[model samples]
Structure formats: structure tokens, C-alpha cells
Target: MRFAKQKRHRKTIKRFCACFGFREPFKVLCDGTFVHHLVANHLADTTVSNTLGAPVQLFTTRCVIEELKSLGSSHAKSFRASCRDYKLARCDHEEKESALNCIIKIIGDNNPDHFFVATQDIDLREKCRKIPGVPVLYGLRNALFLEKLSKFQDEYLKAAEDERSRMTDSEFKLLHKRLKNTHGLKDLSTAKNGSDDEDLLLQSPVNRPLRKMDTKDTVQFKRKKAKGPNPLSCKKKKSTSNSGPNVRKTDETGNDAKRSRSRKRKRTHTAKTSNDGATN
Candidate 1:
């Protein structure tokens, strides 16, 4: 079955290429799950070839690559099969704190221009917002919307069945009873309420007083004396000596006087030297 699916996907790709002009390659950030679904949809012939025109370029971190590999042989094969000619790009393996950060750095460094990131992760969305030109799409939402549309079609079929049968009141009641039994509505509702009550009870704190430990009875105990001089007093004293009155005293008197006297001596020596040179 899987082989057949793969063959069909290849045919679709060929047809798509024949129909639409080859799309300009766009850097696309995709994780394993996104690629898996893309493969499945393409094989099913439900995926719009028009939408698939953009050449997808996959970007991931080393961590995500390892995660994808850990999904076992079949999944790894499907993931690779889905991504034909898609260049795998990875960010700095050590600099990244998370997969999303790695993805962001890759996009920032490689394509500062706008590109598409296909992900359902909220954290990824938040991180991508900081990048100047990257756009992110929630891949899960697209898959889920398609699933819901399929379910709606099934419901439409069921309604049509009900109308055609024109089921009697007793027959309808029997069907409703079977549905309720199969769904376990009454038991599930009761269990759900019980769980909610348990959660509420856990959230409410008990008003019990904390038990005091008898320090006098313990051998390891030492009575704490009153806190005396600040432990930081030595630092304070050193800072004051370096910065306060002592620094000002050196600047105001000692250094200034020495500099003035040195200047006077230099001027006197220069005058004598010039006089001696003129006489010579």
C-alpha cells in the first residue's frame, strides 16, 4: 500500500511539473511532521498541485534532525521520500539553545528576505515574529481544517441516510440509546465532574499551622546572636579611603603643590638656559 502511495505521488509531481511552470525555489522551514503530511496528501491526489508549485527548501536544527531520525525506519523513509531535491540546512549546532532559536538564526543569516516557515508551534510563531521578513504558517491548522471538512461530508451523508430511511420514533430512540451507550456520555460526564471537583480541592490550601522545630532539643543548634556590625563594613571602609576625603586631600594639596613648584622650577631653568645660550 505504501509503495503504491509513493508511486502515485511521483506521478502527481510529474504531472504538476508538466502543468505549471516550475516554481522559483523558496526557502521553506519544515519539521518532520509537516513533511510527513505533505507526502501523504500528495500521494492521495488531494493536495492542490497549484499550491505545491513553490519549491520547498527544508531548514531544521541538528536536534530536530535527530528527532526525525528517532521515529524509526518507515517514518524516516517517508520523511526523506516527501522531500525530493529539498536541500537540508542546519544552523550552528552549539550556539542554539532550542530548535526554534536555531531556525531563527538560520533564517536571519541565510535569507533575511521574507520566506515561509511551516509549523504549528506557538513558540516558533513568537520567535519568527522577531525576524524582519519571515512568515510562519500553522501547518496543523491546515491539516485539521481538511479533516473537519471531511467529517462534515460524512455528517452530510449520515443526514441523507436518516432522511431516506425515515426512521420511526421507536427506531430513533433505539439508535440514540445505542449511540449514548457507545459514547459513554453519562459515565464520562460524571467522571469529568468528579475530576474537576478533585482539581478544585487540590487548588484550595489547608489552613494548618506550621509545626515549630525545638532548636533547644537539637544537638546541631547554636543560638543566633544579635546581628552586630555590618559584614560589609570592611568594603565600605576601603571604598571610603580610596574615594572620599583621602582622595580629595591628595588632589587639593599634595599633588597640586608639587605640580606648581615643578612648573616654576622648569620656567627658571629655561630662562637661565636661554640667557647662557645668548651670551655664548
Candidate 2:
């Protein structure tokens, strides 16, 4: 039994493409096997798929091309011929890192619009499917199929959709533009006539703004501010009246003490007179 078959129609990729809605073209990155499959798809006249947004644009990296060339296989030569028309994506490739790493980096750095990966390599498919927002296309059972989704697929899709909605909305764009202007870029406005700006300067009929008025500038309006019972003033008056009563009570107590002392002095004189008489 043939393990896989490439169909002419785009029925396979439709399911994956439907999940994402893009205003810009959906970029589809390809490796060697992807190109090999594309040849089959091309023969079937299904090179272009029915897309909801901008159609998919196939891109490859220089390393991918180099890898295919080094394969020295008949299929590799055929894959190269099919991919000759497609442009090599300007991707960052370090000698230390593998081609897969470079591809992942590009996928990460490119944002707003998510890119899809097409490959028959099990490793690539598994790696990309694990990442959020990346859809993987592969061949199985004689036909192309999207990556086998697991339970986490729904969660990833939901997250991707939320991110997509956030990024596409006006608020994020305004904030991003503001940040750009604040940091590196300058705010740009179209040229306007000087007279036009002047026309908007004065909102009222007066040529100048209403002049500020101080005491010397104009007669102050003396309208009695609607007087409610001032609680603070009432409290102050109540406190003062309470203190007055206490002060009067203190003065009366002092006078009483003086009278008592006089009476005591009179009693002491009477006692001394009685004692003197007894002695005589």
C-alpha cells in the first residue's frame, strides 16, 4: 500500500487554514520534503490553495536549499527544480545552529501574521506543532494531512486566536505607533498652511484669551456665598461658651474661700479673748 499520495486539490490544507484569519498573506515556510511534495501538488494543479485571506506564499531558506543540493538524490534534484521559482527567505543562520533552529527563530521573530510549516519530516512536524500558532502539514495514508492534533490543540488555537485579535485591533496599533514615536521615530503630520493653524487658535470672537482678573484688574463680585450653618464656627463658639462658664465658676470659688478665711480669723480672736479673761 502506498503510504502517501499528493492530490491536485487543496482540500487537505483547508482545515488548517480556516483556523486562522489573516489580512496579509499567510507565509508558508518549506524544507526539502515540502518542495518534493509541492512538485506532486503542482502536477495535480493544486499549487495554490483556496485561502480566506491573502493566498499562501511559499518561502525557503538558503540552508534548506543547500541541504537539498547536498542530498545528491534524484528526488533532491527534482525538488530543487520545483523550488527554483520561489525566493529564499533572508533568514539568520549561524554555523553553530542547525537549519531547524534557524527556521524556528524566523517563525518566532515574525509576528502579527503567523506562518505555517510544510514538511514530511517527523521531527520538524512535532517541533512546530508543539509551538503555539504554527500549523504543520505532512503526508500520510496516500494524502496530505495536517498535524495530528491532541487535547492541547484547542488550547493552543484559542491562545493564537486571542493573540491575533489583540494584535489586529486598533488599540494595539495606536499604542505601538505611540511607543515608536516616543522612542526612535518622530511624529509626522502633513504640511498645513500657517493661516489654517491661526484660524483654530482663537475659539471665541475675541482676538486674545479672556484676560485674567486680579483685585487690581476688575471689581470683585461680592455675592454672599450661599451660607450654610458653618459647623466649624459653631463648634468654636460652643467651645468658647463652655470655657467661659468654667472660668466664672473658678472666680466665684476664690471669693468664697476669702470669706471663709475672714470668718475663721474672727473665731480665732474670740478664743484668744476668752483665754486672757480666764488667766486674769
Model 2 alpha-carbon miss at residue 233, Å: 77
What TM-score, over all chains together, does every model reach? 0.33, 0.44
What stretches of model 2 exceed 4 Å from their correct place? 1-21, 40-45, 48-54, 109-113, 148-150, 157-280
Cα error of candidate 2 at position 85, Å = 2.3
> Which tens-of-lDDT digit does each residue in 148-264 have in candidate 2?
444466677776655544333354455546655554544323323334433433233233233334578677787888878968777744344544322434355455422122234
The Cα error of candidate 2 at residue 11, in Å, is 12
The CA lDDT at 135 in model 2 is: 68
- Deviation from native of the Cα of residue 69 in model 2, angstroms: 0.4
* Model 1, span 194-239: residue lDDT tens: 4643343233123212223468755795799888787777554534
Model 2, residue 121: C-alpha shift (Å) = 0.8
